[model samples]
Target: MKKYHFIAALLFCSILLQAQERYFLNSDTRLYTSTSTSAEFLGYFKYGAEVQLLSKNENGWYKVKADNLSEGYVPEKFVGTRLNAADIKTVDNENPVLAGGDQYYGGNHLFVLVAGLKARALPDKTSKIKEILFTGDPVPVNYLPKNQDEWVNIGGNFDYENAKFTLRKFIGKRPDFNTLIKEFDKLNPDAIAERKTVAERIVELAWNSDYSKLAPAYQRYSEVVKQLNDPKLIADTELNVSIAKGLDKHKLPEQIVAFTQKTEFILKGIKTKSLFLTQKELVKTFGKPAKTASIGDECGVYLSDLFYYYPDLEVSVDEKQNKAEIVKVFINENNKMILNANSVLDNTITEKAFIEKYGTYITASIKAPHSYSLQFEDSEFRIEFKDGKLFFIEIFFYC
Candidate 1:
């Protein structure tokens, strides 16, 4: 009896240790290093490779168990915590089946589109997007016949209220739509079998922290931001802070800033296009009037609203002798404000060609005889024209 009790106690302790253990974000982008410097690149973890956390350093470095069964110290900023069993189980149960037609049902499973003409989650409007089906597009369905609207044998276990909430976002409020619900009794066994396969795949990928299988996740994330069509959703300081925190976990604050800036720009462009705001409107909302007047064929007030709503708005204008030549604006704050309303309007109309190429979310620009310059935060791209023909194109980014 004493020996059996001791063994039982040992097993309980092992279980506790396993539960407390944390896994690293198994990804290709995370590079393991022996020393905290660019010169040290010990090895790269294959996509979805998880490591056990051992310890941490004051400089945001972490000691972890690499895949080769070796212990090493890696930059804390590049490591992400692994998903646990509960998270994996939840995703597994919620996985959806892929089928033809906008709406299909299988044994208590039902999916509906609340908005947009076609059901899809791709950047472009096509039915072949391969990402995990979310509320926005690539809706999952089961039970309903391919040709008919009526459904039978929907097999999903999602709560009815939660399912309704998700369904309403895509289909909108409608009394007739609500009446479409019916009891699912004769579930297609084949569909259930397929669903299990999908569920297993989702669980396996999610549990293993395997992101490599999802091609271009970041780019797809960008596309999702665009599809949501709400700048406020992506522009919030909390989102930026959250991203910063994620990067901070890996100890990459600089990368956090760059990613946030680029995402902000993309969101701004989407907002600008959605609103259809003209150049004049942009200036009225954010630009400050010119202080000095210069009268010349090539002389004009160079304005910019890049820093309108930011915490610190930096604007500068430089002219050669008495003629206007250059204008630039820099926004250093995290919040939204009317940064460059007037200058953007003037420039948009005056340099239509440039607006077509650079977009209204312009951060910087320079004008010289036969020369033009443009800059997006942390990114420099130049286009040169000679004898009415484009001559050179250069693009680069700085960390």
Candidate 2:
């Protein structure tokens, strides 16, 4: 008889959850433009507000429509077919979920930002402490204040040992419970200790091998050292110092700094020297180019031809009859160039040093991950940086 009652209750719940039914927002819910948490937010629906359930997706997001004809998506866990009146709590106006009522309606998922935060029985700082929350701990939104305080009600009997902050329900993916906790446990003392042990093991291996001779071993060491110096883990100064000292004994080759002398490059000033030489002069100085390309109506009015050297140099030229005067120059890596006597414009220069030397640039654009192109106040000169170091440069001239 009890089994039959249980089955009947399940069927009743399913019927209530059918699409097109009137559903109530279980928590402060957000209507996103799409199913992703990272998508543009349309608006928020207050808790217990009625919404029309259009449908649900495989990822557990509900297609919902509000009374105002506004339609968007909300997470499956943030809505319900029926409301439990007992779940409602009194509103406090002093602290909001986020400051200044900026809290969205559907902020059902949140992660701990600080190291130690207290979970309370009520939405007040003076409320009874249920438990302590730690950094990176993912918590389900229980009740957000409709009044005005930052305090959140996490409910009673939160099982921290067996908590499952599954991403599928939250972020629509899997890291499993154990793995997710490990990721959240970044600041956990044991986890930090484990990382330190692994880093030390890598250092020991790098020390044993002839890093200078084996390129692969040296590359591995360089990667490990980079991670060891990561900002988040830099707090471990003793380990960092010890590992750095161990690796410094190797004394690998350093980048050769070129073009140390200062030379003024006045962008708006008169052109005293030309970056590009005439076709006749180019061949005379560097012999015949490795390749040549003709540019006409298809390219643009300005560029007539391009001359490429054996390696990292390209020269654009304008031709009339048998003579072609250089119009632009592009160079990459290992070049003799000076932005001013104080700053060396070369591949070996770091991005910080470049900016410090040049003051400010007009426009900056992302070329790729960790790569950027910066154009100064003068459009004729464009510089590109990759991996935080100078990558290439382009200088344009009409002559």
Candidate 3:
């Protein structure tokens, strides 16, 4: 009798929970039609979206409804009971730069743009751009802030910081101010001139640390001072003493690797157009690509197992011996961002020199007794040089 009652109670609780199922977005995920990722994309569910759980598919997906009445299936793991946005950790949110002044900076790194930025050859604003730092890149650099001008060095280029960080979007207090100051003090430079320069660099970091906090439309208004002011580092113990008074331990966000998007390079270092997707994932992402020989991309797609065409992007899947797999993708000139950061596609350097900068490429092939082409797997990138200078690049994918 007790066993029978327990079973009955368990069944009732399961039914009640099922009737009122609720789920919260733990991370950003795409809503799909079926349980597999290759399913049709319904829409994007951002972090902290509240959703109503309907039922589970046998393939480990949860059917849910958003407030907009849009229904779709999302992966089970990315959904949870909590809709806490604070728990979502990203790199920029962690170790946020804190209080910076002309003499001190909280954060110490420079983040460049995603589409590559030109590094000016000199400190002056009108100086020529010397190098391009690819987009979403951060340089391991310390700044030397002077007056209203802010500069960043990318491969000998002294570019303006304002170009990228126009407003205070992710600025905050640095978490390691005390430690940095202590380390600076410990650096015992021998000469007075060297000591002064080193000390100035340290102070400049702290001063520029809080620079990213500006939100107002930045103004470069000319100033007229009524009286000449001393432009030296005049020390005042009373004013300087308060800086260490109320500083609470600034905390950093938890470190986490972000999820990759479909367009991202799957391999860590070797950058190609390959996505490592199946036929379903490919269709879901690129929509229907030119497949049959009768209907094909103007550029053509008969040789490969399957081909996809976009003006800026082209993909070709390798045909396995028997099994159908998409391991490799070929990229054309449409999306040049595939050229990794700092790896500019310029005819300024020889193929050998470019390979030196990137290290030994995927592989090297001998085209003739004296000449040869560098390659990796079938889907790897190829570098072609003309008159000893790089001329063109081609890439293919191999799953």
- Per lDDT, the best of the predicted structures is 2
Q: How much lDDT does each candidate structure score?
A: 0.32, 0.43, 0.38
Ranking by TM-score: 2, 3, 1
Residue range 257-356, candidate 3, lDDT tens digits: 1111123342223343433445445455555655432233354422454545543234554435211233233223322223334445443555445444
lDDT of 1 by residue, 213-256 (tens): 22222222333344455686344322322322232234233543
Name the lDDT of candidate 2. Answer: 0.43
What are the per-model numbers of colliding residue pairs? 36, 16, 35
Cα lDDT of model 2 by residue, 301-388, tens digit: 3445544443455656554533443333333443545544455565577655554444222222111222323332222455666656
* TM-scores vs. true structure, each candidate: 0.17, 0.31, 0.20
Candidate 1 segments exceeding 4 Å error: 1-18, 29-33, 82-399
CA error at residue 308 for candidate 2, angstroms: 4.0
Q: Order of candidates by lDDT, top first?
A: 2, 3, 1
Stretches of candidate 2 off by over 4 Å are 1-272, 296-301, 321-334, 362-380, 385-389, 395-399
